[model samples]
Target: MEFALAALFELFESLDQCAPGSRAATLQALQACEGLAPGARIVDFGCGPGPATVALAQAGYAVTAVDRHGPFIETVRRRAAAAGVGDRVTAIVGDMRAPDFADGAFDAVWSEGAAYSVGVPAALAAWRRLLAPAGWLVLSELCWREGARSAEAAAFWQREYPDMGDVTQLEARCAAAGYAVRGGFWLPADAWAAYYGPLEAAVPAVRARHPQAEAQAALDDIGREIALWRRFGGEFGYRFVVAQRG
Candidate 1:
């Protein structure tokens, strides 16, 4: 697990950047929860490398970052410590699908391009339970127009995620889970470029540095995904804003 994560971090040179505004956008969307005090509780649900986790910590929030991958969790922990927020952020190795977080323990829950990793319904239902009353949950997920299911879109999302749906459907899931529809939008693909462009730059450096490494293969795969991301799934790529636990 550690080796896999290490490779991921090494190979995906710009993964942090490719992750939708270095997750600053996600943080901004979730700031609605700021109605809480500065030292409020925040959960970076499925936090890959602690972007939002560290940001929350820096903002004086007590943060808990959870990821199923052992190496990823380790990386989050190390980064938190290195970034001077180790004491403020508690790193937990766990799954986001059905996270083991205690009920209503958080002021906000942040999930960027991860809820779909777990089925949206399950992710929606599960994350809701972790929020304190009035807690906000911010998610940037794959969304498409309701009218069309092109063979291309279907094929792409099926391979990537069989359960993904349009933004409206996702919003319904949130309502079913007791969350209010606070805000939602069709996120522009430019965000993907922000994350991918930096990564694209890093690829050459990695290839040059590790000419014979497996990172090359991972880089190729990421490159392929990025190049085709919008083509196959552009209609559905979206971001959502919600609050719940009422």
Candidate 2:
């Protein structure tokens, strides 16, 4: 598990942005938040590289993009500047589990592919305090589609993320945590490709640089992850869950 995390972080840090999908997906996630008012103040929690942060700024929101990695925060600052949204974006280095912000500090809190790092239920509860009344909470989480589970896919995720749940379960959890689910949709297949394709392409070169047995093990683990998605993608995927503080 440590190697898996190290490999994942290494890959993301090497790139300009860490999360998956295109600019369109980012926009779509933002749009899905019915409670997010235009020109709102937002906290992009666990924002890696600020792809979504720049997108949110471009969409007219003032965003504070927070990530624990300094490089990721630097990337956000650079990208935001290049996009001419520097004034609207502030990149901060901090833990997602304990964001350094005052109570009711933001109109919305957005995270993509990062909430799971802190556990969804805990994230929903903790981050809710950062949002104003009726503020939006937009997050993309890995969830199983309703119905029978594919043995291969289920087994893979059991090892990868044992706490993962289905959409119905997530909605109930949100309600229990004092939020209302506005709407949500599963991320399209292209989203997975966007992240994996680049990582897959980089492996050969990266592998050559790492001839050590430990490095090989990490590479193998990453390879298996991509392969599982390729084979059993339909069995599970990310859901762009948009909720509002109640």
TM-score of each: 0.79, 0.93
Q: What are the per-residue Cα lDDT tens digits for candidate 2 across 129-179?
A: 898999888888888987778888888899989999999998888899888
Query: Lowest lDDT 10-mer window, candidate 2?
Result: 1-10
lDDT of each: 0.72, 0.84
Q: Write the per-residue lDDT of candidate 1 for residues 44-158, one digit (tens) a residue.
A: 8778877778877887889998888666678778888998989999999887887776888888888877776777778887888788878887777777666766776677667
lDDT of 1 at 228: 69
Instruction: Show where candidate 2 strays beyond 4 Å.
Output: 1-8
**Ten contiguous residues with the weakest lDDT in model 1:** 12-21
Best by lDDT: 2
Query: Which structure among the candidates has the greatest TM-score?
Result: 2
